[model samples]
Structures are given as structure tokens and as C-alpha cells.
Target: MLSSHCLNDDPWNKFPFTGFVAMISAVLTLMVDSITTSVFSRSGKEEPHADVASAYTPDQEMGRSHHGDHGLNLSDDKELGSTLQLLRYRVIAIVLELGIVVHSIVIGVSVGATNNTCTIKGLIAALCFHQMFEGMGLGGCILQAKYEWVKKAVMAFFFAVTTPFGVVLGMALSKTYKENSPDSLITVGLLNASSGGLLIYMSLVDLLAADFMGQKMQQSIKLQLKSYAAVLLGSGGMAVLAKWT
Candidate 1:
């Protein structure tokens, strides 16, 4: 006998376990983050600069013959290097999208569960900012991937639609959903844990590590310091937001 009055009367009651679920999500995320870092570091090797250089084609001008054929030789390292960059970019983009979609769906579910105006308003603001930054990151990856227009459209659609889909699902289930119930706790906890782990893995390993260890950052002491500071600031801001939403 689910009734609309049930939510209005027991709003706070569903919250305790929901809060626990969120925290569980956060903790599981941290553990997955740690393990991914460890595994990647262990398996990584100190690649030689010459090997790195060989991955790329020789400069087009340098390789150009007097006959003016500027096409990179199939055997040229530069062509291979460019191909590798393209591969890396596409893989990272897909992984990043997966993480973002997870976070978005969870937030959408939270919104669907609530009749509280205050919560929704705060979430809207945070989510707008979140989507903007995430879009920038994913857009860069997509551009680098150089997907054809159709494939690009499809990926974009998938990223853009996930939140709204979650909202629809949540709305449909709102009557039966109880965020604080023991069953709800276990369900949300495990879901959040999995999503959080995926996010942390993508953020630290797929994104941050790649940038930090890249040659450009390694060579620039000043940029390196600034980037780290920016990371701290971003992480701190997200942490503060967690307090409210």
C-alpha cells in the first residue's frame, strides 16, 4: 500500500541509510582508485626517448623529398606515433564517458527520490557545473579520437541522455523506492561503490596520471606546480560539495 503521503511523512527517515549508501560509495571508490594506481605503476616501464621519438613520423618538412611528396612513409615512425595518439585518445574518451555517466545516473536517481525543492535546486546548480567541466574533458578526448561525424554524434548522445534516462527511471520507481530501508541501503551502497570506484579509476589513472607523466608537464617545472595546485583546488571544491549533495 504505497501512498504519496508516505514520502511526505518519512522524508528524513529514508535519509540515514541513503547517507550510508553515499559514504559507502565514496569509500569503495577510494579503494579502487588505490588499486588501479598500484597496478598501473607496477606494470609501467621507463620507455626510452628514442623509442618514443620513433613512434612519431619524422617532421614532414624534414622527410620531404626534393620531389615534394610529403606523405609520411608507412615505415616512418611519425605515422605510427600519430596512430598511437589517436588510439590512446579514443580509449580514454570511452572510459571517461563511462565514469561520468555513472555519476550522473546516481545524482539523477537522488533527484527522482526527492520531493524536496531545496535539494533539487542545489543539485541543479552543482550538476550544471559538473556537466560543463566533464564536457570539456570529454570533448577534448573526442576531438583527439577524430571519430567520424556519425560516431561522434552517437557517443555524444549516449553521454547526454544518461542523466535524463536515470531521472525517468527514478520517477517511475519513486513510489516503491525507500532510500533508508535495509534493502535500499545494500542496493545503493553496492551501486555507488561500483560507480565511485570507476570514477576514481578513470580520474586518477586514465586522466591525471596521463597528463602528469606526459613529456610536456615533466619538462615544465612551473606548469607542473600550477597544475598540481589546480588539481588540489578542484578536488577540494568537489569535496566541499559532497558535504551538501
Candidate 2:
């Protein structure tokens, strides 16, 4: 197995295989829900209107026509919707970090399990920069959410210790660590696939979709172009980093 780590001989990676499987299952569930909602919404079909008149009141109708007319509108209804959306973004950010934490831990575990000084040197620097940028993104979302101090502190704590916790866990399991086993490959592949799905969904749905489909980005072709360029630059930089990882 001429793979990423020494061929099928490392057990440290295998130790987290069960956790990877569970996370993948959870991600798949969310992906399926997102897909179903998207498809159902696009068809403009809802369960046969159970008493349409009762469902939509005169005030509701007026709100739909007026308040919901524009994303930028400052009506009570629109404000509520926007507030909910902002909260949703923060929740997604928190969950995204949770998913990211799993991988981060695995990376830490690998680093801790190894005695290679050269690898450790690069890992420390790369990880520091990676965490910094990820924190910036998460912080922006949190600031927008306007959560209470305690909640913010809890989220921050989770992000701060995730990798270190993984490192410590890996150190504990180093005795059983075998990095190149067949089990490890399947596990890593699945974890990567799961994380990839969650990230893609969050990026497209919560972040890009909300803004890109909103009045602001939709109205400005130049802004849209610049945003696309920015996404490309960020993605390209991450891809380059993968070469080293």
C-alpha cells in the first residue's frame, strides 16, 4: 500500500476509524435532507394545500407581497427572517468546526505518534496558520450572530482544544498505532468524503447561496465576479497547501 503514510503499518489512524464512520453517517443524513428540501422547493410543490385559505391569512398575504419582496427590506417579517438566517449561519459555523475538529485531531494524533522532527516542524507551522484562518472565518459568522458571551466562550473553547485533544488521544493510542493498515485507508477515505460533503454544503448553502442569491450580490455583476475570483483564490491556496500535507 504505497499510500500517504508508511504503507499499511500505522495503527494510530485506524484507532479513529469508528469515529470517522459515525461522522460520515451524520453528514450523509444532512446531505440527504438538504437535497430533498432543494428538490421539493424547486418543484414549487408542497403537500396538497391543506386548506390554503386557512394557511394564508390576509396579513400573511400582505407581508409576502410587501415585507418579503426584497432581502434588503427592513420590515418586521424580513428582519425576523434575516435574523433567523444569521443564527442559522452561526450554527452551521459551529458544526463545521466540530467536523473540522475531527480531522484536526487526527492530524494531531499523527504528529504526536511520530518521532519525526522534520514533520513536526512543518506540521506546527502549517496547523497554526490553518487554525488562524479558520478561526477568522468562524469569528466573522459569530460576530454576525451576536450570541451571548457564555455561548461564544463555549464555542471558542471547542475550537481551541480540538486539535490538542486529538494529539493527546493519539499519544495514548500510539502503542496500537499502525498508519498503513487496510482499515485505515477505508476510514480516512470515508472521513475525507464526509468532511468534503459538509464543507461543500455549508459553503454553497449557508454562505454563498444566501448572499449570492440575495439582492445585494444578485444586483451587482461586478461584485459577483469579484466574489467568484475570491473563492478561486482561497480554494487555490488551500489546494497548494494540500501538496505539503
Candidate 3:
């Protein structure tokens, strides 16, 4: 008969312990990404303008004034900045999806390796709910990125297939694979830790913080409170799932 011990050492058992270390790694990554993106974005703006201004001749300056070209240049700059910002958001969304996909595959493999009927049932349920919520969160970021349909399709396809692929892999190796082995524990644990950190960082810095600090949320206290409640609800649901699967 399959037992809890056979299912793999409950990594959840290490919660708040190993989780703390993961949080630190995640926070560091978030800060680094933020700082680097900010520095590059600022440099992109200033360097181009400086180069253009330095090369301007008296004739060019006169032509610019005659054509009301200063305003056009400012408009073009705004458009360029907006495009760059959108590209940044798209990249962040892709990275966030990668982290989610890694964790999903791990979870799927664990579930697939199980032979216990009852254990499988509960795991299937929990995984369904888990993926549903995760997809919603990831979908929001992708939507905001405003990707072309083909790219969106590619991202969505990978996210949808990862868990199933993992399940198939696990099933094929079920006889030989030992989920509770020390090697398995260390490998899964480290992957889980890193992926957990990445999700936390993305959720906080890229998703929640961006929306909360935006003009729309900042201007409306009622809306902000509602949004906070929604976040809490989603987080609480995931926390509860942590106890089971």
C-alpha cells in the first residue's frame, strides 16, 4: 500500500524554514532586475537625445523650428518609451511563466509517480485548483503585455502542456524512480525553492506592486481595498493547499 512517506518527503514540512531562504534569494533577484532595468531605460533616453542634440547644425535647428519639429521629436520619444516599456513587461511575463511552468512540472511528476488511489485523487484536485489560480495570475500579466496572437498562443501552449508532459515522464519511470530518495529530495527541494522564489518576486514586484502603485489604484481607496482583498483571498487559498499537496 502507498503511504505518505512514499510520496516524497513533504517539502511543505520544511515550510517557513527553507522558505525563508528562498524568499531572500527572490528578493535579491527582484532588486537586481529592477535596478538594471531602470538604469538601462534611463540611459536609453538620455544617450539618444544627447547624441542627436550634439550633431544638430544651425541649418538643422532652423529647419526644426520651421517644421514645428521639436514637438514631433518629443512625441516620437514618448512613443519609443512606451514601446520599450511594453517590451519590458512582455519579457517579465515570459520569465514569470517560466517559473510557474517549472514548478508545475515538478508537481505533476510527483503526482504521477504515486500509485495510491486516494493520494492521487486529492493531488489531482489540489493541482487543478492550483493551476487554475496560477494561470489567472500569469494570464493577467500576459494580457497587460499585449503580445501578438502567435506569441500568446505559444506561451499558453507551453504552460498548458508542461504538467502533462511531466506526468507522462514520471509514469514512464515510475518503476525505477524513487521520489523519497535523498537525491530526489535535494533536487526537488532546490528546484522548488528557486521556483518559489521566482514566483514570489514576480508576484510582488512585477504584478501586485505595479498595479497597486499605479495611478488608478492609488487614486481610489475603495478600489485599492477591494484589490487587496482579492489578493488575500487568492493567497489564502494557496496557503491552505500547501497543507495537503
Query: Which candidate achieves the best lDDT against the true structure?
Result: 3
For model 1, residues 131-200, the per-residue Cα lDDT tens digits are: 7888888888788767777778988998899888877877877889876665555555556656666666
- Global lDDT of each candidate: 0.67, 0.64, 0.75
lDDT of each residue in 102-147, candidate 3, tens digit only = 9999888878887888878888989999899889988887887777
State residue 131's C-alpha deviation in candidate 3, in Å. 1.2
RMSD of each: 8.4, 8.8, 7.1
TM-score-sorted candidate list, best first: 3, 1, 2
Q: Give the TM-score of candidate 1.
A: 0.69
What's the CA error at residue 52 for candidate 2, in Å?
Answer: 30
TM-scores for candidates 1 onward, in order? 0.69, 0.66, 0.77
Question: How many collisions per candidate?
Answer: 5, 12, 0
Q: What's model 2's TM-score? A: 0.66
lDDT of 2 by residue, 1-245 (tens): 22346435465345555455555656774775466445533332342222123334579767655753456445644444444454455556666666667667766776776667887887787788777877886777666655666777887888889889878876787677655555655565566556655666666666678778999899999999999999899888777776676
> Per-residue lDDT for 137 in model 1?
82
Kindly indicate the candidate among 1 and 2 with the higher lDDT: 1
